[model samples]
Target chain A: MSDSPVQRLFAEPGLEWRSVSPKLTIERRLPLLGLLLFGLALLAFGRFVAEQSEAAGADLTGALFSGLAAAALVGAVVGWFFVVPRVVSAWRYAEREQDLLVSRGRLVRRLTVIPYGRMQVIEVSANPVSARLGIATVTLVTASASTDARIPGVPVDVAQELRDRLAAKGEALTAGL
Target chain B: MSATDAAPAAATQASASASTLRRLHPLTPFFRSWQLVGALAASGFGVFRDDLDKLKWIWRALHGDVEVSLLMRAVGVLLLVALALVFVSWLSWRVTGFAIITDASPSGTLLYHRGLIVRQRSQVRLNRVQSVDVNQPFLPRLCGLAAVRLDMAAGEGASVNLAYLRRQDAWALRAEILRHTAVARSRPTAATDSTEGAGGELIAEISTARMVQANLLDGVVAWVVLVVWVVALVVGGVVFGWRGLVTVAPGIVPVTVGIAVQLRRQVASMMRDANFRLRRTPTGIQTSSGLTSTINRTIDLDRIQGVRLEEPYLWRRLGWARVGVDIAGASDQSHHGASLMPVADRRDAVALIAEVTGARLDEAAVVPAGAQARWLDPWVARHLGVELLDRGAVTRWGRWRRTQFFVPYARVQSVSARQGPVQRRLGLATVYLDMPSGVQRWQAQHRDMAEAAALVGELAGQARLHRAPLRRLEPTLGTGDR
Candidate 1:
């Protein structure tokens, strides 16, 4: 914790960075739940096809695929309990005087600082689960394709506010790409 | 042209008034179909080669041993094919035309119409044009004709090539197009350069000897390795005889064929331009080169985002280097067409880049990738590092070619720092300075994590400073042109 590079990289003195809503964890895991359901359906479909072809002799292939599917299901459950929380916690952003700084990721830390003038567009989106959870995703589009500056798990109203503020700042500093 | 920046209030009326489209020169079809005619003739000769063996058929026909009707039939067929090709080319030329139109935007648009039945149209905003070139292919040059190629700020296939314009008309069109581009086309850069005078200064001219030397040096390393490989194989063949030759034949065939193909390609590209010359022009920098079919290109200084200087190991002793640029506008399909100088003295090349783009070249200021990076790059790590300049940034790398890239901040599209798990454990990261697509990439690989992180803000800040004053600086100069 003391030697965290994310803190070292973006920790401007007296800066209080804004952290996204923690309820984001539940909304993020819904994808894993949907994936788990799809995997079960696929497993059953595979077995049904194997049974239709030869019934008895396909046991080895069936068991192998079943084992792989089971392992993946277990991994997803574990990530739902563990990985999702940390990733959701990692979404932090700070509005600077001239730029907006966003940082995420625990193991592979990512810090992106986009100048207000460089912003081409700001998009706020939400999935059904995210809508229910009152959370939205904010993406900052720049001329550079690789910017990939998106802050997820933001409170819906706050996301809208962030968009307006960013758009206003961008207009104020308006430099064309 | 003043109407280009005029208000968008009369957009409809402007486009209507400029609706009159102009066609290319009347000889467009003849000149454009010359290559097709040549191919048809070669194939005809190849097909009738047996009958025309040493002109025996000619002697036989004269004595009436051969039928004249058969010869007439073949000649008629050949004539029919050539005529059809010319007709098709003529149709296309008739359908193709261009017009300059101003729409709802403050900037003007170039409308190109082509295709006979389908009738396709493409509109390009005049402001996005990066560079314009006047190209005269050999046959066209002989006919006193040229092609105007406009490179936009878009990606691949972004070049709009209008061919077979009269030579002087091509130049006039290029000048007319530039007048509406983003640079405002008013003034040239400050002439604090060696060649003196304002613009049209002869910066560098690649001589025949230097061109040959640079080409040979480019392949010297690969040629040496290939020679050594062949020698070792020969020694093995001698020791092992027939059995060895058979076993090695498979490897030998592909390697030999591959080297030959690569060498041929290198030679062709190297000889593409014979007398390369770089000159300062009123609107930007002008580069004219080629043995036949002279090509004249103007690259606006404002559109240049980065410059790359490459010095091969063999070229180092001769103090020769190649300079290329990353344009803010759309890059050509093959960036080889974007070189400022094919081969020039290192000192002169450096001075030219500084004079034009104001990119300072100070190798000592760059900090090298630390000793630990040897585990990754081994040889090039020592050469890899980055330095920040007030106006731009410079990065040095490449083990053999020794490439140095100078990216001015104003042209930087984005800056990013990335670290994988291994780099994280080692406290290292790589930072890349993003430019427009199709440009050569520039980055500092495996540097101290802290330094790379600091660079993210610092690099972006430098861009802000450089681009702060004015985005519409007409003919932007290097010493804070605003």
Candidate 2:
């Protein structure tokens, strides 16, 4: 079937809205993983002290080391199930023709919109992983930092195109003003 | 005199003749009077501990427990002496000279310089100044000095601190900046609006008790501390039995109580410091606070990029919401960061939103029509495969009040959805709507992904519509798709 005018126009734009890179997802979740590690460490320390007092033959130092390893495994599993998703949600963004939207939170979602005409600056950010993955983030800034909109996970080429187009549009808007 | 007209002429005077820099207080070098001597001493001592441990063998040799190692003993003594000298020198330097060079400008467009062997100078402009934070640590206070911190938006650090200001200069400087920012924002046109004001009569006086009550009611830090203490007590009992609990309980109880008391006082002072005056300016609404030092922030409604209303569960009970504005040309922390409207009742938040955005949120509480039609396809296409709860399961929109809304895309200023690995695997998405505050905002999340996107688009359209009047008219036809 031939593509409709609307669909064709949006096909290129829709590529702009695809999910963020999986690596970006992992990088953002490191903090949550750190927290999980801390919790597991605490759990292991408790378990080790208890085991040391209870066991007669086992060396206390050896038991403590084993407890830490066990705790880390449990923490990774629990964190993967519970915390990783929350972190991922907080670092997500979306793009559209008229504006850019950025949001975070699984339960309480906060979306910030930056109108194309209202954009004061557009920042194209890409880490080494994102660069390798061919994805970059387009951060659309309005007068307010809180209102800055980010569209993450766009193809590097698409992000560059969006930046050029938006910059042109922003210049026109400022010129009119 | 209008504050702008009174801006100090100090910038024009640039004579290298020491007279300009000399007038600055001698103690300006200590701008960061943050326990420099103590910090250095602690760090030096920390390094010395490892060296001391290595020198233990030398001590044994010196005592003839091992063959007398004269070389090792000599090196250890010399190292200790050098460390001790560095510590004393640092302490002496910390107590010595520091100075603040100020221009007549209220923003203190001056240079703050200090240090004997290493001289450092920082130039601050009035317009570059964002916020000034005045902090007094125990030592500086005991020494009758107030640390003046200037938070510049463009600066890389937390703030530029003038180690010790004669307290009087700090107050004058703060007042000067407040007056300057206010006047700078208020041109003749705004000044006229402020004085002729239909809005100035309605003053919101937040009773000190109300401020205190709100903070105490919403605070969970005290409870957390109490829980930690109880847990520690239980752990102590489990580990050392009765004897451990007895020894730890006394120390823990007093310390916890002391912390709680300190927290309460800090909260109370924080509340006491909370003061805001909203007035009509040529640009938009002017919000000034008496936090630590006075701060004046003028938000141009035309320039306001977005608005956010965040109310944590605890704050819901206190009948309060925090309002943040994305303002251009403001500091990263307050303007770009977060400008919190500390403890405002719902009506006040609504009024402030209306006044700031020039959008009446209270007038039309319901969402505009057309959710089922036009934008539905794009909405569904946007949210397809994302996991979403059926709208039936989603609860209250606003934290305190259970005001549900049926927002459409035309009213939405922005819409975005996010997913994690699990959500991605489940093909689920969580979407959010950025709407003008008040009844137009939903108290809860939309169960349908398509519906959320449509609502976001709806608000975005309205925001664009609002900007139509402000857009300048040009003779040239700007870039268009046609």
Candidate 3:
């Protein structure tokens, strides 16, 4: 790192950056488990078809089907064991005095900031799987198409509170209009 | 017989009587209904011609001779359709009318009412009027008429339009409205009557010679023609060998010429503003331009959320740049109305920038990023730098197309510091400033991590101070003034 005094002067200004709940990791992994089951089912179906084809003396078709199914199964295993954990760990958000910042993505990281005054709507949503996992997602709708920000894997109660706070703040800020 | 005694009596008499409602020009319905007339005529002719052919065929089968009755029926049908079209146009002309009502209250609310079936009555307080536009389409221009569009700060149904007025009438009405708005805002109007002074003091203008040079420098036609010709040659050679080249060779010339012509036309349309002028007024800046349909728009000073100074690759060597602003009420994504200066020299560009944004242009020193900063953005590192001013911040970045962004402390909606995995390893971070909605993306990527952190804190504090609502003192009224 460059030790220029200019750089050192601006380092770490004592602001807390908040991470999401730890239980979000388990909630994210649950989808991968379902994906693994689907892949295995697909492999079983392909093998059954291959066995029938072989009995009918179509050896080439049987080999082709078996090879394709094996590749899919391998892809599913690697994705579940490798990609999910890293992506979930990268997800983080923090609420500042006037805006909310959400940053995610491991390789092509993107950071989106949405100001409280610009927000037109705040929504809290939960699907069956996420509801069972006790997690929800909060979405912010702004006038600009590009500034929409969403926070996923938030605890259910926290999502509601966040939505209420954001809506109230947005109202207070735009009251000047 | 005193003048003051007669003025109060006349004011009361006018207010007691109903305001007059004005109708558009008699030719307005003809202009508005021409599209419908043309569509009906075409469809009517097509259907009648087909039916005539079928009737002739039937006549031949039954009587062993084609009949003239079929042609007569077709003519009758065409005439009936034309009559229906004229009737609809008459109804539309009769129903559409607009009125400007001056309310009795001191605030002077202007009520604009217009429509055919569902009436739309919009009340605009004089102080809320931001700008006015006078547009003349090709057909309307032929008849020396124009439409006036009023832009206000209110939400849905805020825009009030008065269409199909004489061009001179439109200008007079615009001036009258502006005069009332100025008075409402407590601004003096002694010099506002002068035509040249209406646009305020001149800041810049695009010369004809400079325009031609800029067009050539843009190279839009060259790039398009080259891409088309190269693609044709490569595809022909790869797919069909020597024979393919021979076959496609004849089409290459026409295709290249067609692309060049289309691109040239597009460039001309974009540069149609013959005398592009920018001026500064007391309340804001006004820009007027266009060769045929002149557009004069005024942007209030406080409405400008952000400004972007761009030096594209072609113009960089010539020291030319363009400036655009994000205005509060402008909802159009094309940003045609947001152009501050289409093209100018670096010196003038910087001067205009300083005029719009209170921050100084040359205060920021260029701080180069370390070589390792290339991991995040390869093209951005060489030119990336940020200057934090007392009241705002300016960030410069990009290689081929350099950009300098200015965001005032009060306008900045949010600030974020980002450190990706690669950036974390390199001890660098990217900082972004979220301006109010409608402004494009503004960010400084690949900066030293420490500096990025310091920027966030400093910007946040400054923003809070500037964002605090200023208490306005009420104007004290004198007993004798009223």
- Judged by TM-score relative to the true structure, which candidate is superior, 1 or 2? 1
Residue-wise C-alpha lDDT for candidate 1, range B232-285, written one tens digit per residue? 778988888969788768878898788777778667657665788787776578
lDDT of 1: 0.74
lDDT of 2 by residue, B292-388 (tens): 4444444445445445545545666666765666432333453223453656786787567655554444344333222322132333332222111
Runs off by more than 4 Å, candidate 1: A3-6, A10-13, A38-63, A127-133, B1-20, B34-82, B99-111, B121-125, B156-158, B179-185, B188-199, B225-252, B333-337, B438-441, B469-482
The two-chain DockQ for each candidate, comma-separated, is: 0.35, 0.09, 0.17
- Kindly report which residue pairs in candidate 1 clash with one another: B152-B330, B153-B330, B200-B280
lDDT of 3 by residue, B1-482 (tens): 12323443344335532235567777877776788878876886687687897655656746736556765686688678777777776776666655444443243445555565776545555556666767776688888898877876442357777778888777777766767666655666534532433547787788977776776666655766678777877887888897867776677668767777877775664556557888777667878777666666767676666787888789988999878887655655325337788789988888887888786766867556656787767767778887777767788886877878787776665555666677767877777776545566557777776666566667656655576331110111111123
C-alpha DockQ for predicted model 1: 0.35
Query: Predicted candidate 2: what Cα RMSD to the true structure?
Result: 14.0
Q: Write the per-residue lDDT of candidate 2 for residues A20-114, one digit (tens) a residue.
A: 55555665555557766776676677666666675664566656666676677676766676666554545554556655555555543445655
Most lDDT-accurate candidate: 1
Per-model C-alpha lDDT, please?
Answer: 0.74, 0.49, 0.66
TM-score of each: 0.82, 0.49, 0.75
